[model samples]
Target: MASVKTTTLPGGIINRPGSTIDYKTGTWRVKRPVVNLDKCIGCLICWIYCPEPAIIKRDDGKIDFDYDYCKGCGICSLECPTKAIRIVEE
Candidate 1:
């Protein structure tokens, strides 16, 4: 298993409500997920499997990732049925 890097608040504790909004976690990524729209069949598997709530349904009936909140965990790539998502080194 791979280790995950994360942000810790000062004193390793969060004091504010909704503190997650203050963090842009994508900076911690060593690898990033990329979407291949050509292979994407509009399946919602990636959205469903993404633990970060990063994958979102778009108005065009396609899906997009909110990279600011994404930790590059690669679950979306693994779950994509058509192999539409790939993980690449940053």
Candidate 2:
């Protein structure tokens, strides 16, 4: 299995979880989750629960975030049940 799960920018959304992480860089090593509009229902749970509030709703009903501030806490993914979020390694 992979040691690291996903790598997000500053502010991003994580709707689901499917991986782990390796934090040996001595930094926060925070990563954001990528959300899929096709599978998202706009539940907004991830947004409300995000510690950094990185989640944002697009004008077209799509959702996005700024990874620059994201910590990759994985709370959003664990909260999401649809598995629409994928954690990418940086």
lDDT string, candidate 2, 1-90, tens digits: 235446864576544563223333214545658887798888877888887666777887657865645677778888877877787666
Reference-based TM-score of each model? 0.76, 0.62
lDDT of 2 at 57: 78
Model 1 alpha-carbon drift over 4 Å, by segment:
1-16
Q: Worst 10-residue stretch by lDDT in candidate 2? A: 18-27
Cα lDDT of model 1 by residue, 1-90, tens digit = 123227657787766677566677777778888888888788788888888888888876678888888899999988888988999987
Candidate 1, residue 48: how far the Cα is off, in Å: 0.9
